[model samples]
Target: MKQTNLEMTHNHLKSIVMAIAMIICIQNANAQFANSFGKQKSGKQHPVRVYFMAYDMQYPGIAIGPEYDFLYATHQKIQCNKGTRYTDKHLYFVPQFGIVKTDVQSVAAFVNIELDFKTIYQSGFIVDLFASAGYAQIFENQPADLGASSFENSLFASHGAFFPQFGIGTGYDFRREFNTPIQVNFRVLSASVDMKEFIKPGLNLGITYNL
Candidate 1:
């Protein structure tokens, strides 16, 4: 009876020790996670970055704009079934005013509002996605012989339309090596003047200097 009691006591003590070790390990892990998160948050000295694209081509035309970083976040140690992944993300808002000159000699003035998403990898490669909506006023210059009696026949007749665009892009970040906040991107875009109609495919290549 004494031997059985001693065995029971030893087993209970062993279980208690195992539980204590598990609790200590969990506490250490939590502390390490907190420290890592704190460091990441502290490293973000600038939350908002300003950038500009002097020449942004939209296939049918060219656009120029300034963009602002609205949100920036770092997501590290994301667990997947295979392994862990780390990345940084950014969100930007861009406002642009541009001129569109088509092959048919139609001239347009447009204003656009765009939202951009960027995901940066550790190797300085970036993937981007963006969407934009714009309104344009197109002026059709007709010959004087066409007459100004009707709207369509009038010279310098102006009409308005809306264009929405979405695209995917790839870029390289120079901030890691040059210590300058510059990024160059190339994008393939598809846009529509009227969604119910046809789609216009375009390309955009630009450089952004973040300040």
Candidate 2:
């Protein structure tokens, strides 16, 4: 009976040790997996990007703009619909202001989300798509007496008028120098005035610097 009791204690101790070993193995595996993907930390990472662009505004002619972006979101290791894994995803809040070459002037504050299908570390070929929405001001060459309220001017900035704007675009980033990226994007901007709709399709060429 004593031998049986001794055997029971030994078995219990062995089971405990094995359980501990299994737990350690799992923890090590998780750490290794995270390290392999460069995902040791997950959540808000702050990065700022600044860029300048020249766009051909279809209706008003050409515009030159500068933008400031604040990166506000990131998701690491997201599985795509095609069964591939994306290493990083980011969202940015951007404020842009532009001058439409003597035809018009505009300013906007907006948010845009970017999904990087091919990361810089993975490939030189970049695929980035974005959508933006926000408020904007359009000032155009108008007669001084067209004197209207801010709201009216914003909605009906004729020849030279003012209004809110929304836009969507897709662009690609290519390595330009050591750490700078050159971007070429095509976008469409739209607004309404006195029940009339105006559409402007434009192409943007810019370079971005990260800080």
Candidate 3:
């Protein structure tokens, strides 16, 4: 059998990438909300929106430890659309990070992109789909049981030669207008790293504010 170079250790690079992902997802949800909500508020050169979409994760084999999250968690986005008087149909860039706060403090990083299309003005909602692909670096404390050994590269990457990760998700964004900045976004996203590794599904709650 070939020796697997892959080891289970904390990945700092993945942490940063995940943070960027969190931010982009949150912003994508918020922008759709703000654009379709109420009046576009006067005197504002740009409009920003915020939203919260419940979050969850799955990583069974690595370590089935206790799952904890910050009760007050959210993602943010900044929109600059130069279309509707330099208003709607704008472009955005988002990056995010998350901390698993409890007895143990663990962190992750992410970054992604967003685009808007189509608007429905009937049930106080915005109909647009978003797909974001990024990487996440995580850390594991040395317990010796789960095989945590010290090595040069504790972090694994998707953009590298070994394996790659591509996550895709979309759902309905509900909000009245662009100023109120409150929305309920539903997303079912999946990502796979290795052949034996399972595809992880994530649901994130995003919150944004116009800058």
Candidate 4:
């Protein structure tokens, strides 16, 4: 049977519509498959982790503050039986502000550029090397006979000094199991308080919570 021109045009349009629908379905399926593959490759993607609260015991004194990972990057290397191992070997800028006490009580604010190396494996061990420069407002203790309160002395005798510090630390991350990411690190620090004088060696025990 010979088809009319109108019928032939209608059939061609129908075929075109069906082809478009099939393409749409294939694209949707491909997107779903890609999403599923990503989930299987990496359990949960957390691009940025925050250290909401951090405690640092700086030798003769202690400094308590918060630091977060910013400008972060990571690389996946070493394919294992389970999957690939992801490592963070990048620069992290951490800013901290808190009270510090040494020979004199002070308020410290610092920004650190850190090179951190860690593996996102079951073990979760981390190593960090950082350098920081900041200012501290030191308050010299008043004499007993001054008869001024501690707050009054701190308010009146405060002076600012710039310092540079370098430290190396190692710790373990407890995130895979607990869901609460906590890192406890022991650090060896060298700080130059006098700016031009010799650097003073110190120890630091730090705890940080990563969210």
**Per-residue C-alpha lDDT of model 1 across residues 1-211, encoded as one tens digit per residue:** 3334345446545544554454465445435533543233324333222222221233256676555453345556677786776677866656656666632646566666778888877567899999988766566666544333444332224555676778898988887567777888888877554457545666776777653
How much is the lDDT of residue 181 in candidate 4?
A: 62
Please provide, for model 3 over 1-211, each residue's C-alpha lDDT reduced to its tens digit, 9 standing for 90 to 100.
Answer: 5324442223334545555555666566546534554223232423333332222354221101110111111222334463222112322332222332111322233233333232333334434344434444444332332554433323332121111222333333333444454444344544343336545455444433333
Weakest 10 consecutive residues, lDDT, candidate 1?
A: 47-56
Error of 2 at 138 (Å): 4.6
TM-score of 2: 0.40
**Which structure is stronger by lDDT: 2 or 3?**
2
Q: Identify the candidate with maximal lDDT.
A: 1
Taking all chains together, the TM-score of candidate 4 against the true structure is 0.57
Q: Give the higher-TM-score candidate: 2 or 3.
A: 3
**TM-score of each model, in listed order:** 0.60, 0.40, 0.41, 0.57
User: Clash number for every model?
Assistant: 0, 6, 41, 0
lDDT of each: 0.59, 0.37, 0.34, 0.51
Error of 3 at 84 (Å): 18
Instruction: Give the C-alpha miss distance for residue 104 in model 1, angstroms.
Output: 2.1
Candidate 3: Cα lDDT at 50: 38
Best by TM-score: 1
